[model samples]
Target: MHSLRPCLLFLLLALMISAVPVSAEPPTVMVADYTISPAVLQPGDVGTITAIIRNTATTATVSEKTGLPGSGAFESSKSTDIGVNIESVQLDSKDVEVISGNYKRVGSIGPGQSIPITFLIRAPAKDGIYFPEIWIDVTGGQSVRQPVPVNVNTQIALLKKPALTAIKTVPEAIGPGDEVNARVVLRNDGQSRADQVTVIVNCSSPSITQKTPSTFHAGSLLRGENTSIDMVFLTDKNAPIGINRVCLTISYVNPDGTITSQDEVIGIHVRGRAKIGIASLSTDPVRIRKGDPVSLVIRLENTGTDNANSVKATIDLPFAGNKAAYVGKIEPDNDAPAVFSLQAGSPGTYTYTLTVQYEDDYGVQTREERLQMTVLDGDATGVVIAGLLVFLLCAGAAYWFLTRKKGPGNA
Candidate 1:
């Protein structure tokens, strides 16, 4: 029984030990992928970044290194995409340091099957070209590498640009807070499609939005062909009155895989910075007898967005002698009419012109219209003479009959 008791104790101890859970080993890791949104920027600019790191069958520290600088004009911050050991932001242009806390690593690119990390990169303030690099180091997994480009031109010039004649505004008289669409038409004077081209349009108003691509290829555009982009300028509620200037830059790819770029400037006029005006005129058709007089009326409207001073209206008068009656100013939502009388001494179709002139705070405004009428004639003078002769003959006959009968019956 004592021997059985010792065996029982041993069995109990073994069962207790078996019931305990075993410890687990950590996971393996690797950095297999990375992405950069807008991998390019100008000096003193910033970019958004994304990265992936993975752990393989073994646990280990994952380290990443960005593409190192190749020239004095080009470089990247180890802090831009560096590990803990190298934690400093770098740039090819010296001015990038002027902006504090612009670029940094968001989180540890720790080891895993694959983990994503984000970052911000700041461009140097100076002008030049820079190629950024990213390198991922895994204890057991293969190293990953990526390169980004930063084209900094203190000159604000695009890399490859195309030729532009001009950028014009559609309605040059838009006030603040008004919606406007401006267009830039470019012809591929070069022998390319204008691929990979970047177009930048600027307006004095920040409310404007351009729909064209930031970059494009010149080779993609054919010669004698034109491509246009629209920029909607949202007027500010309180914009200054006067002329607003708009600037444009075009960067394009050459057929030989080279890049060229160009720039242009345009302007728009705002009279009141918030007012608009409209002018209209209309005419009617009429007929007249030869050697007779005819009259007609003309209607004028000041369908204006604002009040206008010294408004005038004129209409073309037929070749015949004509006179016009003056009409007064037309109020908003109202109209004015003028009457014109003409003597149609001829038998041909007559055409007339009407001109309207007015002055406002801005300047002089004019409008024109045409008037048409026909005059009929059937040998008008001869017909009237013949009718008078016939009437005289009938009068003579009647007078003779009455005179003879009265003479015979008279006492």
Candidate 2:
């Protein structure tokens, strides 16, 4: 009974220890590293800020006053491993305003785990030194905040003047005799704003003329902003096809009340409509013969500034075998041949049409030209030759008879 009392006392003590509450070390998050793009930024400049955060706690142990009986377990502090849950992250600054990605949710971060949070921030209009604070919220209602140092450069100190750049030209391609509604986009790529911006376009080639206002006035343009100007131009009908260069003169007022100008050249492709025609037509033998193989040769010329594609020429005459010839592509001021081998039918003068087909920028077009061909009868030449020989023989016999009879009388 006395030994039982000691065990009971031990058990009571263990129960008392187990009844005590356990304590655990909470999660601790810290900023591992931070980075900012465009390390030095001017006023009104936008930049990206990234912060790398890490939970330094490798393992969290909870202390619980509890132990098992007889197995050497006693009421004492127990340790439990745990991870940290991040709820939100935010950035705050007076010299810079958060443009986007202010708050982010990072669900769970294990021990020694790190996460990267980024924010798009814009520098304040006024230049100065500033400190942006980063706040991290955890699941346990605990928060961590850190301030980041930033330097906002002044536009004057940075000497970042406004720059005008010709972004693009609309209607990249133009053809002769075409009236084009063209658009030119001008962008301000500098850190300072431009005042009283003016853009003037000039044509270097006489074949191109501006039909609209040559100069355009843009009131004001902020940095990183773009404006477009619409203009009309006419391409002369006799304009040579190639690349045409146009000059753009841009002038604007600088922040220091000085006028700055820049000149740029833009090249535009000038394409002309494809025009094809039959330059010459001839046959191998010059004259056609019935039942004989005839070779028809057609010369096609491209008179336009562009190349003619998929050129095909066909003879519509009544003949056998292939009557079509594929000439492929013909370049400007160049000619190609279309030959066909056919057998002529009957003799006599026959009128036929030569059809030329080709494709251009617009679409397919066909041209027909009337041709007069004289085909001789295969047996007519033989007949005519035989008759002429017979006539000559008769004349010779008559002449001999007359001469010989007269001479005999004289003898």
Candidate 3:
């Protein structure tokens, strides 16, 4: 019974100990947490930080000043007596003294409370990962800071190797006074997006009259985006319509930021030929006596890439005499008509060959065209007037003879 009492007493003492109220201790004031808004950014992207700082000291620092180390800080966030000031942010390698106007200073962070410090930082240009280092100042000549990490990237397009989707050339052949058209669509096949891409095109044996915009604004061309361009060629009558080839180069990119370019050839068959039919001349009636003036007309057209420079177009009427005029330069895409007159008053069917010639880098090239001219038989229509005058003179002689005869009879 005595042993039981001791055990009972021990149990009662344990109960009493358990019944005692436990005083909760104050939470340790220590800041180990930080947060950065917008976990990602690009160059010139602004960011801010909200720091939860817990002051561990049971008592507050006498001085309200607090801040991180470093100079050239421009702005400060609300913080301790020593506010946090962030200057212009710059890359450390940029050999510049300071970047200004980045962060602002704020009041001090209190004990067992969280303090938010804001700072701004710029990003570098590239496609890789990166982050910024930051600090916060506190009282007692001690500063606390938390490094916030952020990812930086770009959304710009790049021109990489490009492929062609559609290629078309119009009018395989054009006669001496005609035109041709060609078009091609470029497609981006790589994985990088393409912007402001231009295709430089060159054509052989053909002159370009009209080309699509000299530059192609790919406009964020993603992989598989197609852009089209056009080219026009005016074939000269002297042009040989057979086969012409042009070269095209494309610089393009895809969505993944890869760039590429390729040069390609487009083979076009030139087919049209220029034709010059004869046009009528003035003065159809034939005057078969002396040299009379005859007018000749001819049409000149640019049927090729070459132009007629200081063109002297003339009609060579066989016997009547040849005539020519100095027509100004005519471009391949247009036409000009030349007129000249000659004198041929002979009585024979005359044929002459009129040739149009122009100067080029290789010297003069000529176009000789043949046409038929004729003169008809002349009539007494030329002598009829002479006979009338002779008759009038005879009338006067007869009247005088009659008057003499009558006067003698009367006498």
Task: Give me the candidate number with maximum TM-score.
Answer: 2
Against the reference, the lDDT scores of all candidates come to 0.53, 0.82, 0.53
lDDT of 1 by residue, 139-234 (tens): 333444555445555333334334434445478577556766776666665433566656666345453434444333433466557767665656
- Candidate 2's residue-wise lDDT over 277-371, tens digit each? 88897887886788888888889999987778999988878878788899999998899999999888889888888888888766798888888
Candidate 3 C-alpha lDDT tens digits along 39-131: 555555665544454555443223222222232223222322222222222222231112332333444444445554444445555544553
TM-score: the better of candidates 2 and 3: 2
Would you estimate the TM-scores of all the predictions? 0.28, 0.48, 0.37
Model 2: residues >4 Å from true position, as ranges? 1-173, 177-194, 202-247, 254-267, 381-411
Q: Report the alpha-carbon TM-score of model 3 versus the true structure.
A: 0.37
